[model samples]
Target: MKKSLLTLGAILSLAVISCKKSESGNKSVIKTDSTATIVTDTDGKIDSVSQSSSTVDVNGKKYEKTDFVYKATDGTLVKVVFKNDPKESTVAITSNKKTFTLPKAETKGDETIYKKDDMTARVKGDSLHLEQGDNIIELKRTKI
Candidate 1:
């Protein structure tokens, strides 16, 4: 009887620990159809030419996040990067009908900030190109 009770206690403890680990291991949610909007922050105004829409789709079965692409009014292709884990993150921009990938790190939170250098693509004289896969988006920049 004592052995059985001890075994039961051990099992319960293991279950509790497993649950806690699962909760902590994956703190991020599966983001789908995430919209990229441009807005002015409290500090000052931005010079973005026009607002464009960007979408993110987490491919089913593969369970991987893909790149999101946005075309600004000035022909600058924008990409979003993961905020939490930027080191292994990527930014893909489709410019001139060609895809350009950018090297970046992943970050977290809704209000995240990103830069152009983080991409695998190039930002030359008057063009910004990004590259990414079907669903992987490059850099997601927030002004908050």
Candidate 2:
């Protein structure tokens, strides 16, 4: 029985080693597509942004005027009109259908100042600081 089993195992090993997978003459490797396509939908909407500026003649020199918008405390809208010639600018506060304009900044520095008798306002970057007799408030900057 042992001799028969050894002979059967040897024959099976020889059969596996001698068998070469039948190769057809037309056998070739075909590559699969590994790329994908992407689609984007905008719902037929597009936005356009334009540069806004106005030209002003100052002492025979042209100066461009631009307005930067910001939001103040108490939900008030503050629009600051800036000129390219000088560092002078004005802050306009509109609330409840009433608009008040602050005087042009007198001091020159990083912060723009609007000063009057007792009220002083400063605008630096997106910060709005206001001071009166005994009241002081700061506003946050907003983009439009």
Cα RMSD (Å) between model 2 and the true structure? 21.1
> Residue 6 in model 2: shift from native, Å?
99
What tens digits encode model 2's per-residue C-alpha lDDT throughout 35-99?
A: 53222224443312121446778688777665555566777766555455555456565545665
Each prediction's whole-model lDDT (CA): 0.43, 0.64
Where model 1 places Cα greater than 4 Å from the true spot, the runs are: 1-63, 67-69, 75-87, 106-144
Residue lDDT tens for model 1, 107-136: 344322223543334333223333333433
Candidate 2: global Cα-lDDT? Answer: 0.64
